[model samples]
Target: MNPPLFDLTYCPIVPALEVIGGKWKPLVVYHIYLGAQRFGSLLRCIPTISKTMLTQQLRELERDGLLHREVFAEVPSRVEYTLTQTGLSLLPVLKAIGAWGRQLKEQQAVPELVA
Candidate 1:
């Protein structure tokens, strides 16, 4: 018998987008993918995102199984985020998205402003 055809029940990009397609999620994932990082570090990296919003994004990423949050017991508690295997699989896509964004930005730049 011929092998079953590839699953076509739904668009694959849909689920991928669902996982990484938010205003902040892709940024969160990309930074973590760059390296395991602490909560404060992420907040610094993505300025303009308020602490509450960053916290919300981190919680959602954890809930979606894309990030692992580890708490270190110390005089001051420290929390770090690392990507899960599933999350690792998604990072390259985020990188590509970043590249595409750069290209678009460059393309849209005013010639005078670019100087």
Candidate 2:
């Protein structure tokens, strides 16, 4: 019997994609990689994302072992997010993707208006 064209279980990229897929995932990771981040700063950095979505993504990332969330003992409680070793390893790949996209955008962009 012939195998199915695309098997979901055996594909190597599946796990990686699961951890890093979606519009906000990479952006969230990239921002955290810049330095450890808090909820408020991530919200500011990614202005278009809603709080609900951010919370969901962060939870998934933490579940996937790509993020470490720390809570401090304080009056209001402070939480911070940072990359785990696995997440740090993925940074180069993400950076490459970002560079490729920027190059494509530059090629398609209009000339800048100099002051």
Candidate 3:
């Protein structure tokens, strides 16, 4: 019997990108890290994103095992999203990425105009 062959020969980043490569996924994760658990709160936290796009992003994150969505049985049918253990493990990496972004912005800052 032959074993199944897995293809990961290109680069190591590919797998990571496959999990969190989209423009919105990182932002969604960041917002969730900041305690935006509910759908409405997430929408408000990232106002620039459309409702449809947010929905898509949330679904993808949930499907990828980074997010856990819980629904309550009640009249209003409340729902919430939280980071799973795997998702929480990515927090340090996310923070480092944020720090790099800030450092890059600072390094590229334009000089103030003079009179």
Top lDDT prediction, candidate number: 2
Model 1 worst lDDT window (10 residues): 2-11
Q: What's the TM for model 2? A: 0.84
Off by over 4 Å in 1: 1-9, 109-115
Deviation in Å, model 2, residue 58 alpha carbon: 0.5
Give the residue spans of candidate 2 off by over 4 A.
1-5, 106-115
Q: Better model by lDDT, 2 or 3? A: 2
Candidate 3 lDDT, 39-94, residue by residue in tens: 88988888899999999999988998999999999889999898998888888888
Top-TM-score structure, candidate number: 2
Residue pairs clashing, model 1 = none
Model 1 over residues 79-98: C-alpha lDDT tens digits? 89999998998877777887
Residue lDDT tens for model 2, 1-115: 7557688776777888888999999999999999999999999999999999999999999999999999999989999999999889999999899899999899779687779
Q: For each candidate, what TM-score against the reference?
A: 0.76, 0.84, 0.83
How high is the CA lDDT of each candidate model? Answer: 0.86, 0.94, 0.86
Worst 10 residues of 3 by lDDT: 1-10
Ranking by TM-score: 2, 3, 1
For residue 94, model 3's alpha carbon misses the true position, in angstroms, by 0.7
Ranking 1 against 3 by TM-score, winner: 3
